[model samples]
Target: MIAERLSLQLPHTKVDPRILSALVCGSALALLALKWTRQRRLQQKLEEARRKREHALMEMRTMSLQFKEQNPSVQLEAILSLPLTELVEKLREGSLSPESVLYTYMGKALEVTHEVNCLTDFLPECVAQLQDLKKQKQRGPLYSVPISIKEHYDYKGHNSSCGLAYFLGTLAQEDSVVVQVLKKQGAIPFVKTNVPQSMFNFDCSNPIFGQTLNPHNHKKTPGGSSGGEGALIGGGGAILGFGSDIAGSIRVPSSFCGICGIKPTEGRLSLCGISSPVYGIKSVHPAIGPMARDVDSLALCMKALLCDHMFHLDPTVPPIPFRDEVYCSTEPLRIGYYDTDGFTLLPPCMKRAVQETKKLLEKAGHTLIPFNPLRMEYVVGELFLKGLFPEGASALLEKFEGDLIDPNLKPQLSVYKLPQLLKRILAFFLRPVVPRIAGELKALCGIGSAKNLWKQHAAAEVYCQEFIAEWKKLRLDVVLCPVMGPAFNLGYLGKLVASGTYTVLYNILNFPAGVVPVTNVTEKDEEELRHYKGHYNDHWDKLIKKAAAGGVGLPVGVQCVALPWQEELCLRFMKEVETLTREKSRSTIGPRIEAL
Candidate 1:
C-alpha cells in the first residue's frame, strides 16, 4: 500500500559530452585519412602511367623512321597481312625473320595504340626477349609469332593491373598458365590491352587509361572487358589477341569489331595467375580465349593452348588435346537456327545477318531446322544474376574500396547504390512500363544470403538439365543464333544491360560458343529498326533505335553454339558459316559448298 502511494521513479542518464564529441571526431578523421591515402596512391600510379605512354610514343616515332630504311624480303603489306598459320610457315621456312616480323608488328601496334587507345602495357623487355630467341634456336608452332594479351594475364615482371589502380605496381611473380603455354609455343605477347575498371563493363573506359575507341567508328565502343583486344586485332596491330569472357567479354568485342572470338566451356583452359576483383567465385566463371580476325587463327590459338603443356602446368584442367578431325569433318550436319532469342530481340541488321547465313547454310546442304527459344528470362533474371552476386551486389561494389569508378560504369554502379525502398518504388513503377527490364534489375540489384545462393545454384542446374533435354529432343548437331548486335553506340551499355541475353545464355549453360562475322550494318537495317516497336515502352524502344543510327558498315555477327566440351565441333561450324558468308558477300548468287 505504501509503495503504490509513493510511485516508482527512474533515473535519466546521458553520456559525458567529451566522450560523444571524441567518438564523432575520431571516425571523421579515420575516414578522411583512408580517403586521402587512396587519392595519393591513385595519383602517383596515374602519373607513372602517363610518363610511360609518353616515352613509348617517343620510341614509336623513332621506330617508324628506321623502318623506312630497312628492306623486308616479303613486302611489308604482305607480311603484315598474313594470318597466324601463314606467319608461322614463313618464319620456319626462312622467308621471314623474327626481327622483321616483330618490327612490322611493332610499327603497326604503335599506330593502332595511338588511334584506339587499346594498349595498357607494351612489352618493355621485348627487345631482350627477341635477342634471346635470335641467339637460341627456336622450334614451336608459334615461333616468333607476335601476340597481344588482355591486361589481366600474368607476366613475370610486369603488373597485371587489369584497370585497377590498387594493383598497379605489383608485378606478378610468374606468368599465367596460358602465357607459359604461349611462350612454350614461341608466341611473343608484345603488349597487353586495356579493359574497363572492374573488367565488367562492355564499353571500355577507365579512370587510369581513359577510353578505348572503336576501330570501325571512333564514336562507337569497341566492346569489352575484351574491348582493347578487339580493337588491336581489328586494326591489324595484332594477328591474334588473348582475352577472357564470362559474359560476352570475348564475343561482344569480336562481334562489335567485326572479328572472330570464342568463349570455350569453363575448365577447358587454365586460369591460374590471372588477376580479378572477385576471386574464387565459380558461379559464372570468366574463361580465357583467343580473339582474332579470322576463325582459322582462333583455331590455331586453341590448338596451341589445349595441349599437354598447359594440362601439366594446371592439373585442374582436363588433359584434352585439340581434335583436328572434329574441325575437319565433312559429314552433312543437322543445324538448328533461331533468329531471335525472345529475351532480347536482336536488331534487324543482326537478324538479317542470321537469315542470310541460314539461307547459305540451307543451300550448302545442311538442314536448317527451326529452334525455339529456351527459358531466357530465368537465365538472365534468376540463374545468371543470382549466381554472379549471390552475396548481393553490395559486396561487389566493395571492390572499389572508395577508389574512383569509371564514368561509363555509372549506370551499373548506380544500381548497387539504390536503397531498397527506392529500388522497390522504381521497380513498381517500371513493372507496368518496362516490365522485362524491371524484373531483371530487381533480381540482380542486391546481396544474397547463403540460402538464396543455394537456391540459385539449384535453379541453374535445373535450367541446364532442361536445356540439354531440349537439345537432345531436337537432335541438333549445331545451333546458329543471332549474337547481341549490331554493336551499341558509345555510352549505351548501361541502358541495354538486358540486351546481352543472347551471349550470356550460352555462358550460363556452359556451352562452347563462337562469334563469326556475317555481314555489315546496312541502310535497310537502320531503316527497319527505326520503325520497330517492342512489347515495352519508349525507354528502350527509343534508345535501341537511337543506338542503331549512323551504324552503317558496322560489323554484324551470328553466334554458333554446341554442347559443352564440343569446342572442336563449334569451331568447325564457325569455319563453315564464315566461308559461306564470305562467298555470299562476294557474289549475289548463293554460294554452294560441297555437302557439309
Candidate 2:
C-alpha cells in the first residue's frame, strides 16, 4: 500500500502556446523601449550642456564688447601683446586696471575659441572674483591676470566633468585646492577648457564639448589631455594657464602648441579636488603645473602657487615654497641630453631640436653629457601602464559606459578591452613583430591576482631605484631631451599612444620636467620624415610617420628635466633654453648646427 501510494502521479493542465509567445514578445518590446528612453535622456543632457556653454560664451562676449565701448582708451591690441610679466607690471603701476585686462583676455579668448574650439565654459563668476580682488590692498603676483584651467579642476558651483555626459549635472561643492591658492594670489580663472573624455587620451576630443583643434594648423591636434590650455596660450588668447599631467599631458601639449609648460614633482602643488580619470593607483602620480607663452610666465605661476596658502589648503602636499635663489641662480649646470628613448624613434625635427638645444646650452657654458634612458620599453609597460592601472581598463572603461565614446579613444579602448585569453594569444604572437606593443598589451591585460598586482608595483619601485642610481652616477643637474611632438594629426594618437615615451619617462620617475619651444619645423624636417620606419617597422611606426606629415612650420619643443623637488632648477633650465632660442632667431647668423 505504501509503494502504491508513492508511485501515484498528478494530472497536468496545458497552457496556450500563443500566450507564451505574446509574453516573450512583450518583454522584448519593454526592453527596447527602456533602452530608447535612456539614450534619449542622455542626448537631451548633451544638448543642454552645449546650449549652456554657448550661452555663457555669448554673455562673456557681450560683456566684453560693452566694456570695450565704455573704455576706448584701453588699447586691447597693446595690452594683449604684453607678456605675463609686463602685464603684471602695468597692473601694479596703475597704468592698466584689472577690468581692462579681464575684458581684453575675454575678447581674445572668445576669438581663439571660435577658431580652435578650445574653450568649454566661460566663468561668469569672474566678475565677482575681480570685484573681490579690487578690494585687496596688497595685490597678488598674478593680480588681475586672467588664467584658463583644464576642465577637471574644481571651481565652486561649476561642473568639473571630464568631458563625459554622465557627469554633466554634478557641480563641484568647493574650489580645487589649486584654485583656492590661485584666488588668494589674485589670479582669476575666467574659463574652463575642453579635455578628452576621461582625460586618458593625448589628443583632445570628447562627445560633450567636441574636438579642440590646433590653433596653428586646424588639421593637427594640440596634444592633450591639457590641450585646451596649450591652445589658449599658444593663440595669444591667454598669457598664462594651468594644466595637470600624469603621463605626457602637460609637456606634450606644450610641445605641440609651441608654448612652455612644466610638470612639477608629484604633490609639489595640490591634487585635491581635481577629478582624476583613475584613482587609487599608487605606481604613478598626477601633477599640477602651469602653461604659458613664455618661460617667465610659468615661473611666475609656480612662484605664486608654491606658497603658504597652497600648503595650508592641502596638507598632503609638500610644504616647501618656491626657492627664488634656485630659479634665479646663474650657476652653469651639468646637463645630460638624449634624442631618443630607444623604444620609439622621434621625427627628424624633434631630434634636431634636441641636438640644437644641447649646442646652445653648451655654448652658454653648461656641460652637456650624453645620457641614455634604461629599459624604456619595460618602464612604459610595467611601470607606466600596469602600475597606473593594476586592475586593468575596467575602472576607466566603466566611466564611459552608457556615454558616447570619442572616435579618438575607440582604438585605445578596444586594445584594453580584449578578452584575457585573446590578449595572451596576441601578446604571444606580437612579441617578435612589435615587442614594445606586445609588452604593453601583456601589462594591460589585468593582473590576474592581488599578488600579481603587488609584484608589478614592487617591480615599479625597483625600476625607479635603478633609474635613480643611474642618474646619480651621471651627476647631472638637468637633462635635455626631445618632447614627443610638433603636434600630430588629429585621431592618430589612438594608434600611437606609445610615442609618448619621450615625455612619459619623466612622469614615471616623478621628476620635475618642463618643455620649451626651441624651433619651428623646417621644410627639411618634413622631407626627412618620409623615411621614418621605427625600430620595429610595425604598423605603429607607419602610423606615427603618417601622423607627423604636413607638420611643416609647426612649432617644435624640447624637454628640460631635473630631480624630484627641483622645480625651480627645472624652470631655470627652461628659461635658459627659451632665451637662447630667441637670440638665435634674432641674429643674422644663427648658431651653427655642426659646431659641436
Candidate 3:
C-alpha cells in the first residue's frame, strides 16, 4: 500500500528533478546578476563623485586666478596685515562671526594655491567648524584664525603622504597631537602644505606633488621639507603654519621664502601620530615648530603648543611650561656672529647681511662677539652624513623605490645602493689614511649594523656635549650665521647642496634655531663676488662660483641659534634682528619717502 502511494506521487511529479534543479540555478543567477548591477551602479557613482571633485578644484583654480587679477594689492601684503586679530576679538565679543573669517581665508588660500602649489589638502571641515564655533560661542586665543599644517602631520580622514605616492589613499585614523591641540584652541586648519618626498631633500619636490616654488621668484625653490608652508606663509596665504626640521627643513625654507620659522629643540614639541618615511632612527634631531610672517605669531603658536596638556598627549616631552620671562624680556644678550663655517664661505650678499645684522645688534647695545666654530668642517661633514643614515639610508630610499627622485637629491640617494661588505672593507682600510673616507664609505653603502649604529649615536652625543661645552665657554646666549650661501637659483641647488653644512650642524647638535631676513640682494653685494677668492677647496670654490654667477637679485637670510630647549632665546634674538632691520630701513627710507 505504501509503495503504491509513493509511485502515484512520483508519477504526478513528472515535472522532472532536472526541471526543479534548473529553476534553482536560475534563481541563483538572477540574484547574482542583481548584485553585480548594484555594485556597478555604486562604482559609477564613486567615479562620478571623483570627477566632480576634480572639476570643482579646477573651477576653484580658475576663480583664484580671476580673484588675484581683480585684486592686485592683496598679493604683496602679508596675511598678518589683514584684520585677523581684530576679527578674532570681534568674534569673541559676538560682533563678528567665524564664518566671515573662514570664508575670507578659504578664498585667499584658494587664490594663493593657484599662484603657488602650497596646499596638499584643502579643508572643507573649516567652514563647518566656523559655523559650529559661531553657534556654540566658543572662545579661544586662536578662535577664527586660519592655520595650515605640513603634510607630514596627521589629520583624520586625510592623507599624510609626506610626499610619497605609495601612501596616497592611506587615511590617518586620528589627528596628530599638534592638530588636536590646534583644534582645541579654536584654530581652523584650512589646508595641508606639501613637503619634500620623504621629507629628506632641502629642495622640495616629489613624484606625487611637483615642487613648491618660491613666491619671490617662481623659478627658484622655496626650500624644503617645510617648503610649502614657507611658500604659503610667505605668499600671505597663511597667518601661521606648522613645519618640522631635521636638517634645515624649516630654517632653509624660511630663509629662502623671506619669512620667520623656528626649529625647536628635539622633543620640545609633541611628535605623536606624526607620520614620516623614516621613524625610529634618532641620531639627528627633528622637531616640529611654527612658520609665520612675524616672530610674534610664532610665539603665539609656540605658547599654545607648550600648554601643560601637551605633555599628557605625549609623555616623551618634558612638562616644562612656556617661560614668558624668556620671550618678553628686554635685557641685552651676548650673541656669537660668524660670517663663514670654514668649510663653505658665504657669498657677498649673505656676508653683508651678517655684517649689517651684527652692526644693528651692536647699535641696540647687545654684545656681538666673533665666534669660530671649532672643527666645523670635520664635525658637520662627518656627523651629518653619519647621522643621516644611522640605520642605513637604504630603508629611507626604498620609499622612492620606483618613483622618480628629484634631481637635487639624486647625488645623496645614489650612495644608498652600494654593496655593504665593500663599504665596510673600504672604511676599515681607509680609516688611518683619510678621515672623511669613513663618511664616504658609509655614504656609499649606507651605514647599518648594530655596531655602526651605536658608534654613530655615541659620536653624535659626544659632539652635542662638546658643542654645548664650547658654547658655554664662549659665554654666548645666541649664535648668528648665514642660513646658506646667497639664495640659489632654481636648478643651481644641485651644485651647492653641501652648503647646508652650516645649518645641518645645528640639527646634529639638537639646538633650537631661527631664520630672520636681513636684506635683499643688491648690485653692490653682487659685484663683490667677482673679486672674491674662495677657501681654495675644489668643492667650495665650485659652489661659490655657481652661487655668485648671475644670482644677483635673490633674498639673503641669516640664522640665529641657541642651546637645546632655548627656542625662546632663539626667537628673542630673531625679534631683535627684525627690529634692528626695521629701524635701519626707516632711517634709510624716511628721507626718500618724505621727499617723494
- Best of the candidates, lDDT: 2
User: How many clashes show up per model?
Assistant: 6, 0, 0
Q: Candidate 3 lDDT, tens digit per residue, 1-596?
A: 96588678786645568978998999999999988886665446435433543554565455445645666555333334654455457657866445544545667776777787777777666767766766655577787788899988998887787876556668899999989888877889978888877888777776556677888887777888898998898888888888998888888889888888889998999989789888776777888898887787787778878876688888889988778799888999999989887776767788789998998899889998898877765565457766677656776877875455667667666656567787778777876665344546655454557787787789888878887787888899999988874546665554454568778888888899989887888888778877776664455466566655565567678899998888888888888898889789899999999999
| Candidate 2 lDDT score relative to the true structure | 0.90
Once all C-alphas are superposed, what RMSD does model 1 give against the true structure? 5.5
Runs off by more than 4 Å, candidate 2? 1-11, 589-596
Clashing pairs in 3: none
- Per-candidate Cα lDDT values, in order, are 0.83, 0.90, 0.76
Best by TM-score: 2
Worst 10 residues of 1 by lDDT: 3-12
Q: How far is 484's C-alpha from truth in model 1 (Å)?
A: 1.8
Candidate 1 lDDT, tens digit per residue, 1-596? 64344453423444578987998999999999988997898788888976776676577556654765666343668878887888889887778888788778878888888899998777756667766766667577888888899999998988787787767778889999999999888888888898988887888988888999989999898998999999999899999999999889999999999999999998899989888887755566578899998999889889989989999999999998999999999887899899887766667898888888998998999988899767777678777776776655766677776468788888888876787667768877888877776776677655446676776777788888988898889899989998877778888886677778888888788899999998899888888888777535457666777776788999999999999999999999999999988887667543443332
Instruction: Give the higher-TM-score candidate: 1 or 3.
Output: 1
